[model samples]
Target chain A: MSEMTLVEAINLALARAMEDDPDVIVLGEDVGINGGVFRATAGLQTRFGSERVLDTPLAELLISGLCVGMAAQGLKPIGEIQFMGFLYPCIDQLVNHASRIRNRSQGRLTCPMVLRTPHGAGIRAPEHHSESTEAMLAHIPGLRVVIPSSPERAYGLLLAAIRDPDPVVFLEPTRIYRAAKGEVEDNGEALPLDVAFVLREGRDVTLISWGAMLKETMAAADALAVEGITAEVVDLATLKPYDEVTVLGSVAKTGRCVIVHEATRTGGFGAEIAALIAERSLTSLLAPVARITGYDTVIPMARLEQHMMPSVGRIVTAARKACQFS
Target chain B: MASKKMADGGLPVVARFEVRHRNYLAPDGSINRPLPAFASDANLLVSLYRAMVLLRSFDRKAVALQRTGRLGTYAVSLGQEAVSVGIASAMRSEDVLLPSYRDNGALLWRGVNPEEILLFWGGDERGNHFSGPVEDFPFCVPVGSQAPHAAGVGYAFKLRKEPRVAVCLFGDGATSKGDVYEAMNFAGVHKLPVVFVATNNQWAISVPLRLQTGCETLAQKAIAAGFIGEQVDGSDVVAVRAAAEEAVAAARDGQGPRFIEALAYRLGDHTTSDDASRYRQEAEVQARWREEPIARLRAFLVGQKMWSKAEEERLAAECHERVEAAVERYLATEPRRPETMFDHLYAELPEVYAAQRRELAGEGDV
Candidate 1:
């Protein structure tokens, strides 16, 4: 086991996957000689050779489309978009070809590709750099939307995403790429997808979050412990086809839920979790579900990005409301 | 005017280029140039003629079926048969084809049955499950998107060291899309084994070629991507096949990517949903009918004494019978079960979606 940042873990996972499977290829802008803008793919091209790690031209649509084609031809491709704000161009290829290739071809052709991009706010960056538009991607049917909150999850979940038989949009939280470090064994084991991880178990309330927001959610649980109120923390690793059993089970035990995210409140994924609780676990509820998320307006630039992101204080306040209710 | 000197002295000429057009058989059924070697095979020429006839027969029946409400809105390859048939005929069985909606003729030549084509137009997904040339891509509805797929396939072939080429077919209007340009640029940069065929059908629904772009010819678009681009008289199957064979062979031999722009006219409306008379003149359509691929090939075949009036009638009858049989098979196919929608969505359905599939099957409540 070695202490590694999230980005390093991602690099380690990629190297492990390529070493294991000759059919796996890594391609994106600046992924070859430059080792990617964030250095997530550092030293990959030199180690794996330029053929396995390719530097594509500056076109997101082509990158995604090439992956779909390559995947259809039996090559496992992991494509990267520099940032979430630039992911719009890929939506066309993802929706039209990648997602529905199997359905369209009636099992004749399948798209087993992964598109990775840095997601969410908190990074002091310019416009079109920090975006948490996971909701937009989750809305696409036939796509698996996954977000890893820590170095360990990032390493394990990325391997799982690459091995998945369908297309996956893997959103890596840029804010925590190097913010935290953890011991990640370089084992080639992949964590299961379409499931959630229960980080901290408690009885008073459930603090649900994923991606970079887990930092604040865990902190809120710690803060709530001081106030004599214990909060359960659940990390929804896979946003789409989420682990409803775990979420509903936690809600059933706690009887209260507080969902947090970095995306805007309107039509956010938090609403889906709230509705799930309302439909299945409403009878067990002690208080109405609450959602603490970004405002409906656009995420501001770095100067004001902190206000747009969910903080530990906000998560703790929401958990308090859920606990204090009748 | 005096020439300005550069910082390093005088500017040197960096590149020189030219575009060539091929036409062995003219629209008047006369030879415009020496025929390629393959034209000597009377049996091959006859087969090409038969394929064009079959495509036209299928196209006419498809339009009638759509009009009678038996089929959904369909894209017809009315006058562009030679372009598709020629390209597909040039490709080996191992080659991959990324075709557009109107390339049914190409698919048929590649061994896809007429019944499957009818099934596709009849709004069934099973049609895309091609039993023939299984590696070929299904019909791409979005314009120019398949170009990138072709490049990707070519890249895979190059990476695997496979001596195979990927052929992509699109329309004149698709040349304006950035996707096509980007794909071409990538293929050129990698020298991928890809051949891009642009069927310049002179119309993109209501828009004309003049309105699509200011370029004089679609073939010139390839020059910007650093490759050879040539035009062919699409009405003459001989020229299209010749150009395609050369390009496919060159790409397979690691000579880099090649582009072909086969100029044809959309002798019919864009699709069953379109009415060409609303945007184009009747006189233009009439003039194009004289240059349509099927009749031109038939006229040339008859002149060469390789075909006759009797053979023409017999081939037409055979095509009609074949098409009717396919229509019967298409009509006999039953609708798939509703729950099957979840079957192919993923290799194995996730447990979460199982409830919805069960609900769709009327087995459980969500």
Candidate 2:
């Protein structure tokens, strides 16, 4: 186990994936020579050569479309969209072409490719850099969405996503790249695409979160622990096929829930989890399902981003509100 | 159901005798011109003929399958089977074929297994694509989308200096799409080694010939895109083969891309979802049927003594038997698992989904 930041964890995971699978290729703007703007693919091209680590054209559609052929012809492509907002142009290929290829082929062709996009608002990045629109992706039936919190989880979950036999949208929380550090197990063995990881055990309110905001949830839980509150934290690694069993079981035990994310409260995944908890674990609940989330507004560029992201205070307030419920 | 005379409609009723582009007999089953099988062997001719017959059979079967709810809405290639097969015959073993959804006939000619074809007709992935030396592409359902892929692959060939050419087969309806124009423009500008074969059967779903374009002919559209263009009689296999051969020659000889339009007819329902009678007058269908490629070719072959009536009947019987056996084979195979839906979704599975997949696995195997 080695202590490292999320960015380091991602780089380690990529190194391992590239080492293990000759078919696995990394391609994006600046991903080859510059190791990507975020340095997520640092040393990858150097280690694997420029052929496997491609520096593609800036056109998103071509980047996405080229992967379809490459993957079809037996290459595992990992496409980096740079930011969550930049993924829009490639959505048509992902949603319309990649996701449905297997079904459209009546089970003949499978798009076993992975896409990584940096999501969420926190460090005052430019517009479209920190946006997270996972709900629209949630509506797609065939895609699997994954979001990891700490560097350790990023390495493990990313390895698993890369090995899964479907198209995976690996949503990286750029905000936590430097902030979240943990011991990473860089073993090439990947986990499943539908399991949720439990970060902490508690008998009080259940704290459900993913991506970068998971740090705030943990911080909030620790703060609450000083006040004699026990919180159960669940880090949702994969989003589309979310671990309902883990979440529902925790909700049934804790009997309270607070969903957290950097995305806006309106129509976020928080709403879905909240509704599910309210419907299933309502009888055992000690509080209404609360959510500590960002406001329903566009991600502001720098300077004003502090007002947009859900903070540790927000999670604590939501937890307190949940514990006070009759 | 057709009018006694062709003068009733605004369509030019070009007489077969005056139709200068003949390499086969007229509709009355008499040879009108000598067949130009210059570069082909007898084996290829028989293969092409057999393929054209299978195409007709498969189209009928797919239409029936769609009607019975066994398949999704399909695009049929009924009247233009000869052109599809003849053009496909021109492709070398290493050549790549890019075809629209309506080009099922071409798929058969290109050697996609009949059983696999049936699976595609039944909406199974096993039928979607066959991985083999044939190098044929899966049907392009989005109309003109495959043209760009053809150009891309062709560009790769040019880059690699491979002698192979990419044959892009689409329809007149697809010509109107922006992707088609863009792909052709790129292919021309880049001098990509691509042969653009337009099967101008003259309908964009329900749109008529006039609605397809005001250009005098579909081949003209290719001229504007900076490629040599030619219009040929799609019903005549000899003419289609000659045109395709010439176009492919241009692409192979570093002359870049060329467009060849095979003007033919679409003589069936678009798919099970379509009812042609609702749009076209009964007389129109009958009028189109009079120039059926198969009947004309059969007559021409008989006149030249190269083909026999007994041989034709025997070939039809063999085709029917082979198709039936393929269908039987598909029936024998077990139904695909439902989780195959998840197969190949990603190259790797995340740790988070293990438990859920376990649950799904425990529930029952699809």
Which prediction has the highest DockQ against the true structure? 1
* Best by the lDDT measure: 1
For candidate 1, what is the recovered fraction of reference interface contacts? 0.72
Worst 10 residues of 2 chain B by lDDT: B14-23
Q: Residue by residue across A187-275, what tens digits does model 1's lDDT show?
A: 99999999999999999999999999999999999999999999999999999889999999999999999999989999999999999
Candidate 1: where is the Cα deviation over 4 Å?
B1-12
TM-score attained by chain A of model 1: 0.99
Alpha-carbon DockQ of candidate 1: 0.83
Q: What share of the true interface contacts does each candidate keep?
A: 0.72, 0.20
Compose the digit string of candidate 2's lDDT tens values, residues B1-366.
Answer: 133256466656543221123355466656456656562365566666678888788777766666776667777778888887888878787887877777776777666777776776676776765743434567777777666557656655765578888888888888887657766776777677888888888776688889878777777677666776778888877778888887787788888998888889888877767888888887887899988787776665666566787988899898888877877776676767665655544344433344345566675332
* lDDT (Cα, tens digit) per residue for candidate 2, span A1-326: 88999999999999999899887888778998799999999999989987678776565655665565445444677889888888886776677766776666544556777888898877777777778898778767678889888787788888987876677889998888988888887777676667788899999989999988888899999999998999999987778878888999999999889999888878898898887777667887888888888888777778989888888998999898888887
Per-model i-RMS:
0.8, 4.5
Give each model's whole-structure lDDT: 0.93, 0.77
